[model samples]
Target chain A: MIRRGLLFVIIVAALALAPPATAERLIVSLSTHRVLINSNFTGTELVLFGAIELADPDILDRRGYDVVVTVRGPQRNFITRRKAQVLGIWINAESREFVEVPAYLAVSSNRPFAEIAETEFLRRSRIGIDYNILTQRIGTDIADVVPQDPFRVGFVRVMRAEGMFSETPNGVTFLSSTHFRTTVPIPGSAPTGTYEVETLLIANGALVTRETTAVEVVKQGFEALVAQAARDQRLAYGLLTALLALLTGLFASLVFRRD
Target chain B: MRRLERRRPFGPERAHVSIYLPIAELPVNLFVILGLGIAVGFISGMFGVGGGFLMTPLLILTGVPPAVAVASVPSNMAANSMSGTISYWRKRLVDIALGLVLLSGGVVGTAAGVWVFGVLRRAGQLDLAVSLSYVVLLGIVGSLMLTESVRAILRAQRGEPPVVRRPGTHAWFHGLPLKLRFRQSRIYVSAMPVTAIGFAVGFLGALIGVGGGFMLIPALIYLMRVPTTVAIGTSLLLVLVTNLIATVLHAVENRTVDAVLAFTLMIGGVVGAQFGARAGQAMRAEQLRLLLALLVLAVGVRVGVDLITRPADPFSVVATETFQ
Candidate 1:
């Protein structure tokens, strides 16, 4: 009887400490979970539809809230080489290496991110393409304190040029006070990895609850097998390739004799 | 009542199929890859070339990674050339002795070339070196082929007797030591010169990683004075051996060969060769030579432009296979 009484009291206290049930504000659903790449795969666009639940009646009376959605690809190490003129020819001079950086990144906000959040908040949340970075190790961390922003800036610029990093200030559209949606575009050159989807809720020029989800991008069919073989069976893959070249040539020659 | 399903504008979900490239790390349309194979294969059969120079750049243009393109192209070329070699062999056109001699030199040349490639690569000057050599080699080869073929064509047009460099015709060549007889080619030349020629071609082949057939044919004809038919067939035979060895090296050492890509390209290529060989049969030998010369010149011009042009970005990233 004493144990049951203690459990009942703990439940009551937990309920009292929790946020108001009516304060439930974020509800999200992704159009899909997996991106399949086949022969016709050019690229893909994903629709993220979500609704904002509110307890305050006045909020519904005015504009709902600002929404920011950012999608990031898997992290990996990359090396960037800068070229300088050497003997009247361009050659790689300085090299910077970075670790734990996203292979691809896309950021979309309902308004200019600067207008919605302060620089500190934006940096913390990584709401912009250039701001929300998870930099771990850098190859050119000279002095361990000297500014690395220059190389970082170059990295972003290079990625942007390659269509691997993109940002749109007004990409998100609000259909109503309670519903908002956005479209995330994936380029054909996007690497295969797990992609992170982040949705942030903002109210009264302040931070609100943020929800993060994940999606996967993978290669299927013959292409996947090929890549897998290269990674797992490199020698075999090479041998097979050479053998195929020989066989195909032999076949063509034999099949096409005129005399 | 069922509601109508609205179609989204663009998405991978709508794609019916895509052929994924393993080493290239991308998916391509099946038809596109097949079509490319066929086109390159057709050219290979018609000219008795390995088609590596053509296919490698084409793959790069279509977004295959440069390392993968370079490593994988030779294998594909080997396959196409093998078929052409077989056809030529059946016709008794291949000078087996001459091809073997050249191949022996090619083996040594390839080893030396690989060492050079490694040294240049370590210094980060490989690209520049390769490009420079390509520009020079193509320029010389292109002009020589063009001039020689034009002369032959003009003589044919005038109904004049064609110049044939027969056995023992070049006294200097006949005077060389270690003379060997190639019955098929009907020539007696020193093994030293033939091997030397083979070595030069082989070394160049290893460095470039393209088939040696195109470059080798002209040398066999003009330098050692091998007949055109035997030259083409022997060149293919030499390429077959050299390329096979190169493929094994790249696969084992560099690990850059993509079997999927090689096979995808070869499928269309093998089928297309049948038609191309037939087409080549209809043309005169002089016309064929002239056409081949022009094609060689075109490649030279294209590479020459790339060397001098101002690049949009002076910087480029070289992704190491450390992660791979």
Candidate 2:
């Protein structure tokens, strides 16, 4: 009887704290917020469930509703080099540096991004990867170029090939009039960092509401300790590694001694 | 619902035993690495060689990045040489004085090689440098060994007596200044020549992840006129010390040494080497040398082909701070 009373009080409190119904509000939840990368870690998928809290309960206008989910991993600089044949041998020649781009990016939407919003709005809001600005350093100039630029195209293509960047139309599926979910794939080579997951609610070619959540990918256990030691105490780590090599060698010799 | 799981060569279900390499930051099949270690160990034991030259290339073929593969080799070398060094030391064949002089020079050479490795990596020419070096070194050594073995075989078939070299022949290098007496080797040689040899061996070891035994043994025997037993023991000692230092340098400078990977390879290699050693004793020395030569040539040719051929994709992408 006391447990039932407490549950009722929590529901009343949630209703009391909720915003007054004025515009559509987004409620999102991730299957997991922490991804531990340890031994035996291959890759993993995360599910994101979201629901639209509407002002009116009776009217169902799901036909006009759209959802787009963007998951972006930590940003890092990368260099895309194009090889040229120099003296009958291929070597890296021309290079372009992409400054502060998402290391991993996945864009998922209920339908194609173009149909959900105007081109101008999409670019302004950074709804899609192409629409997102990626600055590059070309010799002296540092600015974003056209989406179709060769270097930009090549960078995206290479990242996509490595399973670091992806885009899937109709990735988000609506379970009911107001509920939807999508899957986010974290590849084996994914860098450990805080990943931001943004969910956008689009209605009539304009975003009505949006929500952002965070997921942390971390190296745990022995993997974490080793990486940490290598980075932080490098000299000591080096010495220890050498010592370990000596010990392992000596141990093997002792174990397999013929005399 | 749209399925977003991209097509991978092996799904999670397909890979039952996988281990994450802390430095490489990738999960690799444990069994595959172990099996490779065993195969290389077997070959190394049968041939009485370090096997690092074979191990590094095989690791690269198994999808390990070249930098990691190169750096991780030193630790494995250190382990592989330890047993031989210990055994040789017990027999009192090692020239400790000579080994120390070589090590002094080796340290400097290793430092220089590590710096060169960093520079080449930054220039995006490390892979090219590595491949080119392998082609040149392996090709020369392989052909030399092959011809020597073939000649020996022909001589035996003709029922000819083996030519034996007279001991105590002084070389031009022996007249140089700063001569040092190595009691075990029973020779007083100029420190400069000995140090120079060590420098070359150490430099190659650091750059290409090899023990340089093939070069050292021949140089010691032919150039320095050291006795075969002493040369072998001293060479073993040099390989052990240089590799230990190389591992330290690689870890400190390039930060490319993966201890986990090294340990895994060592585990398999040590066990496999024992069986291979037994099998090697049953085979004729000339036949064994020929087989090793062919294996070396094959690997060299394979690397050379990759260098000459045009890559399918002209564009490559790397993080600004990718592994060296």
Candidate 3:
């Protein structure tokens, strides 16, 4: 038993040393992990803080640190339309469908995202709002999705107008050399789901390490019951709504009757 | 301690209660929804219309998703029509024989329309089809009503004697086969035509977010020669039933009906309908008809303009909800 335990510890040590870059060097957490969306809920803010796990003497010389924090809500598919003037009337001429795009997305970085990482890296990791959509699930193949289209642009524009997708440069502030913080405002229209808070640590214009944590947005109290009933017991809920209307009408007629 | 308090993860609490809508996936001020309901209810009561066409657009403008708005309006409509039908029934103006026949057809048509609605929705053709149909139906009906009401006002000014007709007789649609006598309507006509009319109205009403009252009343008076009082009551009864079907379909099939949203609206609607009925009594029938015609035309024009003109954002996004 002792020999086996020693071998397990040695294996863990070997794995830990094999790729220091693959291990999460930054510790990230949110002040509030669960957001209860009650009837009184309007909007709320998430305070995310993180710190470097390891201290290095040449941290300043190692091309400094860049933090990119993103809070992504549930995934959903969206069909976007692009209008073109036909016979002097603009209609939905061309359309594209995108799948697996976060219903809500917010990004905050220590500096401009362009300054932190190349466009290709940001696009691959979906680090920014511009590249965080999967288009062409319908009416076109996945291979044709690249080279973003006007429909994709429209989706971002609409979400931004609704305050669902947002980016604020200089949103992250470093309290100290190794500690960083950000504030992501949860909009009133944010869908109830498990939101992912991701903190990317970049050095020398490359991603060095990252950390992620989950924050659940859920309906509570009466709100929870109603939402659940509408989704789970839909047929019964519908019948009840109809019955309530019939009863209200019958009750009102008797109460207000006059001869 | 002060610093600790300041570092709290969430912000200070809001004083007003904001209702969280499940299907719409948004939180809005409680009073705002109630007030919207009252406004639409007043319009419905004043004009003798279902008001879904007006209410659905207003809800969409207020940031409720189109699908949710289309689904939830029928709930309030059911309540309004039920109450209206009750008053008419008490007055002994309802023709149960005629109402029941039309309603049988309405039930079948609404069921089929909902199935078509589901199919069209999955194919992403619902919005375009609905918009096109609204422009066509509202434009044609509004213009025809406007002209007819205008002529009535003119004929009245000229002091022309009112047209009189004997009851228990049929004029239009009398030649068709499958003839049946509607004792209350005092007509002998084919069941095929009546059922066809009922089917068309119910199908269109479900496809669009309407209760079919505005269109159905006129058809009953002009085409079927139903007495105005009886037509009103019958129309309300039909509206109540069809609206229920549409609401249930939207709730169960689409999962877009938000109960909380509908409840808040109902609170305002039931009360506002009473006030509207009283106010409507103060106005002349001619004035009311003219006003309603103008309103209908205006709505048609607004929708038509959206189709004809260039949209600000040429592209629109409809998020297909993934339950997971």
The top-ranked prediction according to DockQ is: 3
Instruction: Specify the poorest-scoring 10-residue window by lDDT in model 1 chain A.
Output: A139-148
In order, the Cα lDDT scores of the candidates are: 0.73, 0.81, 0.76
Task: Evaluate fnat for each of the predicted models and list the values in order.
Answer: 0.59, 0.67, 0.69
How good is the docking of model 3, as DockQ? 0.44
Q: Which residue pairs show backbone clashes in model 2?
A: none
lDDT of 3 by residue, A36-139 (tens): 98876777888988987655545565558899998889887777767677776455666667777788899999999998889989987777777666545754
- Kindly list the per-residue Cα lDDT of model 1 for residues A73-122, writing each as its tens digit: 98766656565656655555676656667887999878998889788787
TM-score of chain A of each: 0.86, 0.88, 0.81
Clashes of each: 13, 0, 1
What is candidate 3's TM-score against the reference? 0.88
CA lDDT, candidate 2, residue A253: 79
Candidate 2 chain A, poorest ten consecutive residues by summed lDDT:
A55-64
- lDDT of each residue in B1-324, candidate 1, tens digit only: 000011121223443455566566555666666788898888888888877766765666565655566667777778887877887788899998998999889988876776676565545565666666766877787788888879988999999888857555575666788989888887778999889888887787767666777788888887778888899999988888887777777666666677777788888888877777778889987788788778777876776666566555544443444216
Per-residue accuracy of model 2 over A183-243 as CA lDDT, tens digit each: 9999877888899999988888877788999999999999988888877777888888888
On lDDT, the candidate that comes out on top is 2
For model 3, residues B148-229, the per-residue Cα lDDT tens digits are: 7787788778998544344566565678898888877776778877887778767876777777887888888878888777
